[model samples]
Every structure is written in C-alpha cells, then in structure tokens.
Target: MKNVFIFTVIGLLFLSCKPEEKRTDYIINGDASGVYNGVRAYLKEKDRTGRERIVDTAVVVNEKFTFTGKVDIPKPSVISINSVNGNLNFMLENSVIDISIDKANISQSQVSGSASQTDFDAYNQGYAKLKKESVDLQNELRNIHRQLSSGSSEQLQSKKDSLTDLFTAIRQKEQDYPLNFTRTNTDSYYSLVIIEREINKKNANIKDYQEAFNNLNSELQSSAAGLYIKANLTTLMVAFEAKSRVDIGKIAPNFEAPTPEGKTVSLNDIKGKVTIIDFWAAWCGPCRRENPNVVNIYNKYHSQGLEIIGVSLDGTRSQKDPKQAWVNAIEQDKLSWTQVSNLSYFLDPVAQLYNIQAIPAVFILDAEGKIAAKNLRGNALEAKVKELLAL
Candidate 1:
C-alpha cells in the first residue's frame, strides 16, 4: 500500500510539471443582428502592394458568424458583409474578439476583447474630429471659389483669403496629429504603424520619424512594423540626401545627353541668364498637357536670355522604338527648345540626377546655374521667369 501511494504521488507530480498549451489562434464571434441568414462576411487585409485581399470568409447563420485565424502580429483587417456598402475595420490579434455588427452601419459596429483594436479605436476617434474640420473648411472654400468664379469683388476676395488661412491651419493640424499620437502613445502597437506611414509620405522628415521611433518602448521598437521602419531608414536617408542635393539655392547638377538630331548637349552648353530644366515624358498625360504652357513660356522669354533644356524621359523597355516616340512627342507637342534624351524613360541618367520621381518636374535656374525655384506651373512659372529675366 505504501508503494502504491508513492507511485500515485509521483504521477501527480509529473502531471503538475506538464507545460500549459499557448493560444496562438484568434477566434472572432460576430453578431450580425437583423441581418438575414446565409450572408457572407469577408475578412480582408492589404497585401504588400496595397491591394485589398480576402484572408478568410464566414457566412452568417441565424445572425451569427465565427472566424478563426493566426497572425504573427496584430494586423489591420476589415470585415465586409455581402451587399453592404461599408466595412467594419478592426485590428486582428490572436484573441477571442466579440463584434456586435450594425448591419445598417458597419463602421459604427461595436468591437471588444482585442487590446489592439481598442487602441486603434482611440486613434481613429481623434483623427475623425480633425478630418471633419478639414471637410468643413473645404466646403467653405469651395463655396467661396464658386462665388469668385462668377465675378470678383474685394469683399468676396477678403472672405476667400480668410477661409484659405483657416483651411491651411486645419490641414497642418491633420498632418501633425499622427506624429503627435505616436509620441504620446509609444506603448501602443498602432504607434509603429503611424510611424511607418509617415516615413513613406513624400518629403517626409526622416529626422522626425527617427526621433519618434526611438521614443517607442523597447517592445514596440522590436515589433514587425518597427523593424520595417528601421530597415528602410537607410534607403529613405539616401533619398532624402538626394533631394537636398537638388534643393533651391543648390547648383543644378550638370549632365549631357543625345539631342533629337543625335548631338550631345549639356546644361552648361545651353546655360543662359535664366535656364529652365524641364523633365518630361512622352507617355505621361500630365506632361503632355503642361507642354503647351512650357512652349508658351519659352516663346515669350527665350529672346530675353531665357534658355530651356527639355530633358525627355521618353523610353521604356515595353515601348517599341523609344527614340521614335521621343522624337514624335517633341514634334507633336511643338517643344521648340533644345531637347535631349537617352531614351531610357525614368532610368535616364539626367532624370536621376534631378531626382525626378514624377513627370512635369521643372527646375528653374539663375544665371550661375543655381536652382532658383522648382515645380512651378502656369502663371507661377511665367512670373518667376519674368522676374529673373528682369523683364
């Protein structure tokens, strides 16, 4: 009997030492009240290319549905119902989350049980207020613009100016909110998401994003989003440096390329009292549309010491006879200025020197070949050229 008791004790101790199973899967219990049976709910997420793709699907039976999945980290997901106009957005994590769906208004649906979702909700709530204010300001500005279109009066102009100032202030606030949220909510995983988004914006301040990432707690800094931002910072830093190299007041980088007639021409060769380095492409609709204005500007000011070097980004591997297309566009658009191209599209060496990401990019230079202004269009371009030429 003593031996039996000792063996039983040993077995109990062994059972006690066994490890508990870790829960890695998430289960979503959804209550689509007032919705008819057999409706499908799609779980959606964005792929690396920013395309929305379905991750899972479940059908509502008796106004109830369930979704089961595993995610390495919290992900922003959407639950879209069949025949519904809007989506129910939530942060999907490995937890049992309960969602009470409002079929008539999916965005207003209630969610609980995921800490990440709670934080996401808080962030949205703050952002929505600013968004509403921006919308209101935009509406007012549109109304004033409509009035100005009919006729211009000093009072209407004054009101338009006042509304423009308000709109600008609200927009600045909207841009600052996400960064401010990251600073105050460093512990929240959503902060890392915000930082990643800010890092991707055009002309994003890398210094500010770096500071915000550093302020995050160690755990968040080690998360998937944080690591992505860290890894891409080096590339982004390089791009930022390139931008600084061509900034206004910096000497425009000089390069030579083949002209339409097969002669090599450099910026220094065509340098004048005022020079306009116009980056354009054959297939770009916007560049084509803006060409007339450029031609007009050249005709008006070329005799007044204004020089234009049209750097054509007019070739792609997919294009048949890229040089033919470049020559055709120049003749078709009536671009009379000295035109040059390597016929390599965006891969053209001169485009890379100017850091041209989009077509219709313009760099206006002073007599000394320093970039005086950039990206000016229409009246702004004409005005700057006129001022620089002392016309």
Candidate 2:
C-alpha cells in the first residue's frame, strides 16, 4: 500500500513539471495604423520555403494598429513590411510589444521590443548617431570638391594633408573599437563583417582622395570618387581574383588572345595608344544591349586616339544566327570597331588572363598602357571617356 502511494505521488509530480506549450496572441499596437493596414507583409524564414505571404490587417486609426494571429510566446521571427513607400522590419520575441517609428524615415527604419522602453531608446540613439555622421561626411566631401577646383598648388597640398590626418584619426578609432569588442566576446560575427567592410571602404576612399588631390590635373582629380567606387566594386567581383581589395591606379595584369582573323594578340602590341578592351559574350542580353553604347563611344572618340578591342566569348552560338549570333548582333548593333575572339567561350585565353568571370567587362588603358579605369559602363563610360580624351 505504501509503495503504491509513492508511485502515485511520482506520477503527479511528473505531470506538473511537463513543459508548457500554449497558443498565445498579441496586438502590436502602433502609430499610423492605416499605413500598416495599407502595407503588405512578407514573412521570411531562413532555410525554408513557402512560408512567405501577404499580411492582411485592419487599421483602427492614424496611429493605431492590431496584429491578430496565433503565436507561441518567447519565440523569434522576422516580419518584413513592404509598401509603396518602402520596407520596414520588426522582430517578434515577446508576448506583447508596442513599436513606434517616425513615419518620415519608415522606409529605412526598424524597431523591436515587447513592451520595453529601455531597448527602444538604446536602438534609436545608435541609429540617430550613425545617420548624423553619414550626412556630415557627405557634406564635407561636397565642400572639398568645390574648394579643390579653386585652390592653388600650395593650398591644395595643405588641405589634402589635413584631410589625410583626419581620415587616419577616424581609422584609428575604428580599429580600436573592433579590438575592444573582440576581447569582450560580445561582438556578433555579422556585425564584425560589416565593420570590416566599412573600414576597408573608408580607407580606400581616403587613399583615392589623397591621390586625386596630389595629381592636380582637373580631369584626373574629378574622377576620384567614380574611380574609387568602380575599383572597389570590381575588386569584389569574381573576375578580378582580387585577394585584397584593389585601389585605383594599380596596373592590371597582362593578358593575350586571338583576333578574329586567327592572329594572336598580346597586350604589348597595344602599348603605345589608349585602348579599351571589351570582354563580352554573344549570349548575354546586357552585353548585346550595351553594344550600341560602345559603338557610339568609339565613333565619338576613336579619332582622339581611342582604341576599342572587342574580345568575344562566342564561337558556336554566334555562328548559328543569320548574321551569326555574335557577329550578327555586332553588325546589327553597328559595332564597327576592332573585333577579336579565340572562340573559346569562358575558357578564352584573354578571359582567363583577366579573370573574366562575367560578360561585359571592360579595361581602359592610358597612353602608357597602364590601367586608367575598369568597369566603366552605361553613362559612366561615356562621361569617363569624354573626360579622359577631353572630348
């Protein structure tokens, strides 16, 4: 009888200690209720599909909202709100939360909490500080450009030196923050990655600015930001094999390929004049579309020592069309400049030499055959060539 009673007591304790899994719901009351109702929400789940859908909600007033759904309390999920204005994000982690964001910056803004005032204020403070700093830097850069055009040699040098010192100080602060956070084991991996990328970009821009200011030539100096942005993008591209990010003015690696007439051409052959080598395949839509722009630039600047060499990555497909796909596209597109291809597709010698992982790659060489620019496309290409050739 005593043994039976002990077993009964154990059973009751086990039932009482079982984990609780209850269905719960919360209303995410907010300002601009109609704005939330008018917007659609896409819920994203990593490593899963078919979990996304448009959110249907009812708005009560200008600054009130009701989110009705069955949710498990204490679990986290990301809700992405999309509207005509833009996207807003929220993290649902608690049983109840009230979020209020300024309507003006809603597109780029986000907030998260579950009835907590402390976390909201902390997040907003960091966001506001970052935005202010970004704006101030942009304004300073604009003023520097205006002053650059009018400054004498001595004045330019002095200004350049001062800017360099300022950038160095900023970099030092950036490095210290990373190191300090790393020691604390509190820095998130993604946050560290973002910080590293930003620091590298900032340092690169600073270096480019120093070079431009030192050059003194109006044209060369004017293209600094454009060049910096392009070089940084190209460095990130798969074609460049850039282990470390490349800076502007660095010499591109030498490459070779066969001309359309079955003659081998080397970079050395085009050393004396400015040459723009166009790397494209016949199958690429963007490549075909951009051909006309290339032709126009060539026509306008060819006489001014502008040499464009077309390196086709097509062989079989380009030969199949009525005009022969690539050749037809070229002629149809009115590409009358110099053309060459080994018919090797991606394996083309020139493509491999320049690490051509993508179609529509371009390299512009100066009079001395050093790399002047890379990846100048669309309006940027026209603007750059006009400046370089002084058209």
Candidate 3:
C-alpha cells in the first residue's frame, strides 16, 4: 500500500512537470455593446515557412456584449484586432486579452496592448522640434527681408551679406544638432561593444550599413522613426556600396534583356550617354502613377543623350498579360524608352542584388558606368537630367 501511494505521487509530479505545448487560440474580451461593428479578431502567425496564417472567429462576450474567446496560441504569437471604429490597433501576449471600447462613433478602437507611449513621445518631440525650427527660420528670413526693403542700395547689400551669414550659421547649427542627437541616441540603443563591432566589421566602409541594418530587431526595422534615428543609415550604406562596387568615370553595370519588340538590347548599346534604369512593375501602383513623370523626362531629355531602360518585375503570376500590359502602358503613356523584363518578376536577380524593397525605384548612371543618383523621381529626376545633360 505504501509503494502504491508513493508511485501514484511520483506519477502526478511527473505529469505536472511535463512542459505544455504552445497553442493557438481566439481570445476576445471587450465592450461589444453600443454601436460597435466591423470588429475583426483573428490569429495571425508567421510560421516556419515565413508565410502568414490568419484564423478568424466570432467574438464571445457577456451580458454587456463583451467578447471573449480562449485560444491555445503558440509562443511569440501576433494578434491583430481590426475595428473600423477609430481604427483600433492592439497586440496580445500569452492567453486572455480583454478590450473595452468606450468610443462609439468609430467602428473599432482601443485594441489592447498595442499602444507604445515611448514611440509616441519620441516622435512627438522630434516633430515639435522640427516645427519650431521651421517657424524660427521663417521669422528670421522675414526680418531680414524687411530690413533689406527699408535700406538703401549699399545698406541693403551689407544687410543681405549679414543675412546670408546668419542663414549659413543657422544651417550649420541645424545640421550639427541632428547629428548630435542621432549619435547620442545611438549610444543609448546600441552598446559600445556592439557599435565598435559594427564599425570595425565594416572597416568604416559605408556599404556595410545594410548588414548592420539587417541586424536590427524586426520592430525597430519596421519603424521609420527607428530608422530615422539610425541617421539615414540605408542611404549611407547604399552610397558606400556603390562607391566600392562601381568606379567613377567608368562604364556602369550593363546587361541585356528582350524588349517588347522581341529584340535584345544591352546597356553598352545605349552607351555614350546618361541612362536611367527604372525598376518597376505593372502591379505597382506607385510605378504606374510615376509613369507620367518618367514619360516627361524621356521627352525632355531624350535628344540630349538621356536614355531610359525600364526593367519590369511583374512576373508571370500576375493577373494581367505581362507583354501586352507593358506594351499598352508604354504606348498609352508614350514611354519611348527601351523596356525589358527577364520574366522572373519580384525574384529578379538584379533587384535582389540591389536590395530593392519597393517599386518606382530608379538609378541614374552618368556617361560613365557609375551610379550618378538613385530614386530620382518627380522634380528631382528632371533637375538631375537637365543638370547632367546640360539641357
């Protein structure tokens, strides 16, 4: 009898000690009463495959119309609650999340655990500083203008010189202030050991910024405010990479692909001029919208040795006919540039090499093979073409 009791106790302890497997579940708890509708609750997981899995369910609540559901969610789960009311955003951890919406006029709001006071405070401070600086600068400029208007010719010139000096001083101070803030914030976020490791690993080479960027946490990586703190780190990295890979006053990276005319064209064939390689796709809305601008650039500078090579990434998986769509868009938009695509679409080797994340991406190569500038769109693109081609 003694042995039996001891064995039973041992068995119970063993069972209790067993680790519980992670689970996925639906849990909704919040005020469902009032005019709340268009509230969506679901389980979204980024599995081993790196694909998102969304599981939807109806929320269950109490007499007050509160919604709750118990779901066995896996560890490190991401929960998305979408409400049309005030556009609520929230996140949950472990089990049992409860939400109470006091706002009625909006569809969905106050998804619990999503708001970050730290982020809000940081962004607010940064924006406020920016606004104050702008106002101060404007006021200063107006005062200078008023002084110039009231002065004689020689007095006005002296005042103008003084104003220019003041402007230069202000600009320098502005630049210095941001750099100081970024450096200080960087130290707070990254350890001295980590930063030294980063700097040494890159050997001060700017191109290695991307590696450091990739090392950032996913949340920090996704946040623009976070990136801003990094000090335009991506741009710096790209600039370094370009410097190392491509030489100034040399022919740029040239390749060939089939144009809509079933003819092959290479960058060398378009040599002896500045060229704009536009990386875009039929499915990209921004690229479509910017097409008009590109067309205008081509027309304005085509005669002045400015050539364009549009590389489309709209792979065969898209709904539209790739060839016809490219052709039709070109003809309709009057895009008189050399257009080509390898048909690999997003998986295009060139895009991967360049680390392009969004559409309407462009790189302008001068008469030499070097990348003169990147993402030159709108007035910027036009200004660059005119300046480089002396148009």
Candidate 4:
C-alpha cells in the first residue's frame, strides 16, 4: 500500500510539472453580424513575390466566421468578405484574434488579441491624418496647375509656386513619418516593413536606413522582413556604389566587349574627346525608335571629336542568336558608330558596371572622360553634345 501511494504521488507530481504545449496556430474568431449569412470570408496575404494570395477561406454562419492557421512570423494580411468593397487589414500572428467586422465600413472594423496588429493600427492612425492633409494639399495644387495650364499669368504663377511649396513640405513630412515611427517603435514588426520600403527607394540613403534597421530589437531584426531588408541592402549598396562611380563629374567606368565583327573593344580604346556611351538592345522598341536621333547626333558630331560606343544588351534566352539580332539591328538602323556587345542580354558585364537597368541609356562624357550628362535624348541629347563639343 505504501509503495502504491508513493507511485500515485509521483504520477500526480509529473502531471503537474510537465510543460504545457505552446500554441503555434492562430484562431481568428470573427463577428460579422452586419454581413449576410453564408457569405465567404477570405484571409489573404502577400506572397514572397508581392502577389496577394488567399491563404484560407471560411463561410459566415450565423453572422460569425472562424479561421485556423499557422504563421512562422507576424505577417501583414487582410480579411475580405464577399460583397465587401475593401478588406480589413491587420497583422496576423499565431494567437486567438477576435475581430468585430463592420460590414458597411470595413476600415472601421475592430481587431483584438494580436499585438503586432496593435502596433500596425497605431502607425496607421497617425499616418492617415498626414495622408489626408497631403491629399488636400495635392488637390489644391492640382486646381492651381489646371488654371495655370490655360494661361500662366504672374498672379497664377505665384499661387502655383506657393501651393507647390506647401505640397513639397507635406511630402517631406510623409516621407519622414515612417522613419520617425520606426525610431520610436523599434520592437514593432511594422518598423521592419517600413525599413524594407525605405531600402527599396531608388535614391534611398543606405547608411541612415541601415542604422535604423540595426537599431531594431534582435528578434525583429531576425524576422522575415528584417532578413529581406538585409539581403536587399547588400544589393542596393552594390548598385549605389556603381551609381556613385558613374555619377556626373565622376570618371565613367571602363569596359570591353565583343564588336559585331567578333573583335573585343574596351571603353578606353574607343573613348574620344567627347564620348557617348550608348546602352541599347536590339529587342528594345524605345531604343530602336531613338536610334535615328542618336545617328543624327553622331553624324553631326563625329568629325567634331564626339565618339560613341554602342553597348548592346541583346542576348536574351528568347533570341535564337542574340549576336545576329544585334548585328541586324545595327545594319537596319544605320548605326555607324563603333558598336559592341557580349550578346548576353542584361547580363553584359559593361551594362552591370554602368548600372544599366533599362535600354536607351546614354552617358555623355566630356574631354577628360568625366560623365557630363545622362539619359539625354531628342533635342536635349543634341544640345548636350553640341555644348560638350563647344559647337
């Protein structure tokens, strides 16, 4: 009896001491009282490629809907109902989240239980006010510009300038809001989202944004959004350094590629007193259309010390023979300047060196090989070439 009693006590202690299983799944209990019964509700989120995909679906029964799922991390998601004009946006985490859906005004829907959603809500509440002010200012600016388009008198011009100033001020605020929010809400997952956006901007200051990202809590920094930013930051840094190397007043990066006749030519070998490094591809319609203008500029300026090196990005996988297409395009367009290509499409090393994202890219270099101007086409191209040649 004593031994049995001891075993019973041990069993009870073991049951009491065992750790509870941690919940990894989310249960979204939604109250859609105002929505019609039997309507379908969709839980949607952006995939890695930024495409909105439906993650789960549920049917409203008795004006209520429920969703059960698991997420590795907090994700920005939306809950949409059939016949609803817009979706209810929230941060979806692995927890029991209760949402009171407002059928008429989806934006007014209330969400509870997800901490990340609370941070997102707080950010949006402040952002919405600034957004509204910006919209109002933009409307006023548009009205002024419309009036000016008819005929710009001094008075109208003054009004337009004032409105422009105000519009610019509001825009600066809008741009700064995310950074400010991130600074104060370092623990919020939304901060990582904002940092990702800031990193993706064309002219993003990598240093400042990198500092902001580093300031985030260790857990937030290791999240999906943070990891994405970290990877893209490295890419952006490479492009940024490339851009700096080719900026106006900076020496153009030198490169060599195969000429149409199967001869390799380097930029240093072809550069002249006034050089035009024209990046184009045979398959690019805009580049083809712009060829005539470039040809005209070359013909007029070639004898006067203007030299052009046509770098073709033509070897896409679709083309059977990228080299033949490039050669054919040159002949078809009457491009008489020195032409070169690797027949490797956008993967051309020269194109990568110059940070060429699109075709019809032009970089005009002055006497000493410094970039004088960029992407100047039509009349602007001719004028810059004339200026560089002192004609």
TM-score between model 1 and native: 0.64
Residue range 201-275, candidate 1, lDDT tens digits: 888988777888899999887877678778887678788878888999999999999898899999999999999
Ranking by TM-score: 4, 1, 2, 3
- Of candidates 4 and 1, the better by lDDT: 1
lDDT of 3 by residue, 83-134 (tens): 5234333333334455655455433343443223222235346656766765
Cα RMSD (Å) per model? 7.5, 13.8, 13.5, 6.8
Q: Which tens-of-lDDT digit does each residue in 1-391 have in candidate 2?
A: 9999999999999999998763366556555543544554443322112244444444345445556565432222344444435445444433556655455666444444453223334444555655565556556656776777786477666766676666556555554443333233221222222222443553343333233233333432234333443365445443223412222465656666665556777666654356788888678788888988888888877887788888888865445542256667677778886677777788777777776778888888777666778888988988877777766
For model 3 the local lDDT of residue 236 reads 62
lDDT of 4 by residue, 64-156 (tens): 999999998888898999988798878999999999998889878999999889999988888898999899988988898888889789988
- Residue 10 C-alpha lDDT in model 3: 100
Query: Highest TM-score, which number?
Result: 4
CA shift of 361, model 2, Å: 1.7
Clash counts per candidate, in order, are 0, 2, 24, 1
* Candidate 4 segments whose C-alpha is farther than 4 A from its true place: 1-27, 35-42, 49-69, 82-85, 142-159, 195-211, 232-250, 256-273, 279-296, 302-305, 310-348, 356-361, 375-379
TM for every model, in the order presented, reads 0.64, 0.42, 0.42, 0.70
Evaluated against the true structure, the overall lDDT of model 4 is: 0.89
